[model samples]
Target: MPCIPRLSAPHFLSIALAAASFGAAAQQPQLSAVDLARKNACMACHGLVHKQVGPGFAQIAERYRGDAAAPARLADKIRNGSVGTWGRVIMPRQSLVSEADAQVLARWVLAQPQQQQPPAR
Candidate 1:
């Protein structure tokens, strides 16, 4: 059998540094399909966690939770940006997003976990 080489202190430190760097990178959340859509300027109106000129992403998730048909309904709404649910906030329809993009975005959005704010003290 071949003898195993021992690692020196500096070699061990380098290994630790490399592992730490990789761990930090892995801890970051990946951009979802919808995130790309948002970065493409879809969020000029709609927001991720809070309400802006448009309804909040959390609000949409809440409104459609458990609805089997919400994906289709939301996809249509995004494609057209029609108003009525949240009120007169006209959702200026997006022609920039494609049908596939709409579907991917809808699924990613609907799949997001809901976050609640703490009661104001």
Candidate 2:
């Protein structure tokens, strides 16, 4: 059998570090809807409970509640952008977000709970 060359301590350490990093990266958790929204800047204009530049996530959920087509409509709006739906606020197109990601975001927005109204005294 041919003799194998031994790896030096520095080479072994570098290889080990690279392997550890690769494993860590591979084991990273999947991105949730909220994470995806934040990554795509959706949270910049829409908040979970209150409106920012646009309507809140809960408000969108409330508005589209019981509507079967809401998901598709919202996804379309997300990808292509929209206007007049929420008055003069213009939702610029998010061309960088994938179709699947847009759908996920739409579903997430639709799942938000409506804000509770104060009880009348």
> For candidate 1, which ten residues in a row score worst on lDDT?
30-39
Displacement of residue 100 (Cα, Å) in model 1 is 0.7
TM-score of each: 0.65, 0.76
RMSD of each: 9.5, 3.2
lDDT of 1 by residue, 2-113 (tens): 9999999999999999999999998987567867666667678778877888877778887789999999888887787788788888877877777777777787778767
Local accuracy by lDDT, each model: 0.80, 0.93
Instruction: Tell me the spans in candidate 1 whose CA falls farther than 4 Å from its real position.
Output: 1-32, 117-121
Which candidate leads the pack in lDDT? 2
Q: Residue-pair clashes per candidate, as listed?
A: 0, 0
Clashes in model 1: which pairs? Answer: none
Task: Please provide, for model 2 over 1-121, each residue's C-alpha lDDT reduced to its tens digit, 9 standing for 90 to 100.
Answer: 9999999999999999999999999999878998999899888899888889999999899999999999999999999999999899999999998999999999999998867899999
